[model samples]
Target: MNECERCVTLTTELQKDFIKKECYDKLFKQYTNLEKHFISLEVDNQLEQESFQRNNSFLQQSIPSFDQLFEINELKAQSQVKDTVIMKLKERIKSLSENLKEEKIKKELDEIETINIELDHRVTKLVTKNEHLKQIYKQLYDSIKSSCIRSKEQCDNLIKQVNIKSAKNSDLNASLQEKALVITALKDTLRKLKGKSEVDEAVTLHPIDPELLKIDVAPLAP
Candidate 1:
């Protein structure tokens, strides 16, 4: 994957880990508190039982020593009061446990909700970044495509220019050939004229003027 995709993947993994950890921590803390409360309740029950047993033992020990019937009735009354106090303590403990459970549940839900909100925010950011990256990639691709088209057009233009130059060269070569043929023909005509002139000179006219010829012949005779 590209850099942007890699980064987004890593970030998503990290967010998942963070959410898991937060949930674990919240659950662990709630469980620990619950355990502690249960332990406390157990200890309270044990202490209440021990106190009841001790009171019973004391009442038993003192019963025979007190012969007065009124004293026995008062001792009975005190035992009833102790039983009532224990019952009230148990009820209070039960109420407190229920409240603690409710509070713990509420807190856990709140934590979950907060985590969800954070996750949503992170997702939004990742989505925005992904879109932005996509745009950038598209732009780059378009630019590259345009550049390729331009390059191809330039190459085609160059080829056209070369073809035009070749055509011009061909025409110039043809014209040069025609000019050379013409020059050759002119040279041949000039050579023929010179040959005719030489022939004419050899045919020198037997003197058109006979006097001119006789002067030359007599001079030689004299």
Candidate 2:
């Protein structure tokens, strides 16, 4: 047997010897208590060992494999690359939008400049036409004035002749008065033509005045 059992057997034999009953009982109780304590310690140690083994097995199962770690790293790198590409694309789009806006503004400005130039050309053409009309009207007035003056001189000479021929002819005198009225009417017409020509020149020279394409002149009565 083991040491504890051998000690218990020796104590039992001593019980029949000269040992007192109280001492023997006390010694035997102590040995029994010690044995029980050792048994409890052994059981606790066995339980601790089992718990350690189970924890070790769980740790092994929870650890990641090498291939899994490599895959996770690759995914992180790809995500970073995609983010960089997206940033570049956004910058490019912003630049293109700005350029398009500038181009549109430039196109509009060019159109406005072209319209202004066309308007300038139209104004120049109108001024040129106005100048030509003024020259024609001036020449026409001079020609009419010359013709009327000549006719007046001829009528004055005719009046002198008629007055000398018909001193008491009331009908002849009335006819002469009518001829004088015609000469006065011709003078009025010449004055009006001169005034109208001046007005047309002023209108053409003014910056904001509209072009006058049509002009009305009174016809001379026969």
Predicted candidate 2 versus true structure: per-residue lDDT over 104-192, tens digit per residue: 57756876897699789979999999999999999999999999999999888877766555544545555556666665566557558
Off by over 4 Å in 1: 1-67, 192-222
Per-model TM values vs. the true structure: 0.55, 0.45
Best by lDDT: 1
Residues 54-117, candidate 1: write the lDDT tens digits: 7667767775454544555665566566566556656665666686678667867986998799
Q: How close is candidate 2 to the true structure, as a TM-score?
A: 0.45
Candidate 2 positional error at 24, Å: 99
RMSD for each model, in Å, please? Answer: 19.0, 45.9
